[model samples]
Target: MKRKLIAMLMAGVTAVTLTACGGSGETSTEGSAANAEGDKNYKIAVLMSHQTNAFTTAVSSGAKDKGTELGVTVDILDGKQDPNTQASQIETCIAQGYDAVLVEPISADAIVPAVKAANEAEMPVMTIVQQMKNQEDMAVSYCGGDESKAGKMQMEKAMEAIGGKGNIVVLYGPMGSDAQLSRKAGYDEVLKNYPDVKIAFEDTANWTTEEALSKMETWIQTGTQIDAVVAQNDSMALGALKACEDAGKDIPCFGLDAVDDALAAIKAGRLAGTVSQDAYGQGAIGVENMVKYLNGEEIEPFNYTECIWIDQSNVDEYIDK
Candidate 1:
């Protein structure tokens, strides 16, 4: 065990040294910032894609709680679901000499340059919930759900509920975002098996309830039969559900991120079901991994939490967690 730990520490040191040597001659103090302050006193910056809904907020809450428990300072910066905002924030974290950074990216491709800059500065940037482009080269590690798997599970369940044959309206997240792309990939994979199920209408809601409501209202006006609503996230799911209810159109809705509201809706028999990805757990674990990396300890390149299916039959088992 001691030898293995030593090997891990040596590998980390070598990587940092090489990266730091290749950087512009200006000295970067981030490497020693945590050590100088002593263990458990390091500062970490958590860059969230956005806090527009409960899921992102829950992730930040968990990170903050873990930071407190670990006796480290954790600051969360909102990106407002804008790649530019996230990139700007990453620059600020680098300038502020933070010990580490955790990012929930707004766009996988758009966030690459910022991540590359962090890498050039020899600042460890870990991704949570969403991935940046070339994740293996850009970020130190990733901690989140398997978006494709989650999408697959969500679509499969929705198909099962609808008997695999119906017209469904798909509400998407921000296009080009990691979750949006990967989850949709999962959706498409399942869709290949259900030839009778057609996508009646689809559009991007940008992961907001209001946006989803507006989109659904517009789609409803088209007068096309929508049997089930499959949303990438719960906020959009609830919004789509609301539009159907207001229009007196009964439709079964499925969503990911089994948030509190979604869970309540399931128990109330308003929602069909949702896939539960532990947003809070993802945040907490990301912070934990950051600490390990900072301390020259071994950390997994990919840390994924389990995604569970929740409906009235199993909603009780997941209500509190």
Candidate 2:
């Protein structure tokens, strides 16, 4: 592990040294910024909150690929849905003296102090997909989907499937997570326009398929009239679909994060639709900019990526990719 971290730091620093001393478009943010920072090697540590789905795999792939393209070292850590684990990992990165760190925190609040510590130590920390709370002066930047917009898009499609007014079941992610909260806000905003639309059941599964399936099955057994399922992410939507299938019933389900399974479900006419946050781009671009900023370049504090809507009408164009 030590050898790998050394290699990453050296690789990144060597690349930056060349650009710092010779590049035309590049401007130094400080005097001898790359070299004078001591013989310390540059490295980027990425902490992912969880990796139970294809979305996180794609995100990790994108960041590592870009790191290789630019000769930077990328050290990745998995928090496994635990905020305490994530916070501990961030501290480890700081202790190791990494140049910069990237994080996909478990929630908006749990990972703040760890990030705050990194910033206090003068190591720049940034976030992807899941945002951090109280990120004013502590964290450096963010790159992810527009949570509210993604949620709004999913609810809109579900509403149409239910004929504008019906009882909708909402399967949210972990409570207090940035995506979970932001997307719910969007759902609330749109629901106001149609007063008759009601949220029949809303709960958090902590973002696991099994939990969602269990909750959905229990709901079905209760004989409650549910017109549609609106999930904050694709995993939950698929779980809801499984429950509906087991109960021998059909219900329209809308979800966010257009993973391969979601796309296939839509193609098979099982799901209503899903929103794509471009997991790959979120990781790739977030790290690319982090490297550039560390190399004395300017970058945006909040880099929200564009999202795409996918359904049966346009699922083919996105499935393979």
* Deviation of model 2 at 274, angstroms: 0.3
For each of the candidates, the C-alpha root-mean-square deviation to the true structure, in angstroms, is: 8.7, 8.7
* Residue-wise C-alpha lDDT for candidate 2, range 111-219, written one tens digit per residue: 8788888888999988899788886567788988999988888888777888788888999898888988999999988898888888889899777788989999999
The alpha-carbon deviation from the true structure for residue 19 of candidate 1, after best TM-score superposition, in angstroms, is 30
Candidate 1 per-residue C-alpha lDDT over 1-321 given as tens digits, one digit per residue, 9 for 90 to 100? 001122222223211111111123211112322332265577688888877788898887667666655556677777877789789888987887878899999988989898888889989999999988899877889999999999999999999989999899999999999999999999999999999999999999988999999999999999998899999999999999999999999899998998899999998999999987788888878987898898888888999988888899988877754
For candidate 2, list the clashing residue pairs, or say none. Answer: none
Listed in order, each prediction's TM-score against the native is: 0.87, 0.87
Give Cα distance to truth, residue 62, candidate 2, Å.
Answer: 0.8
lDDT of 1 at 23: 20
Best by TM-score: 1
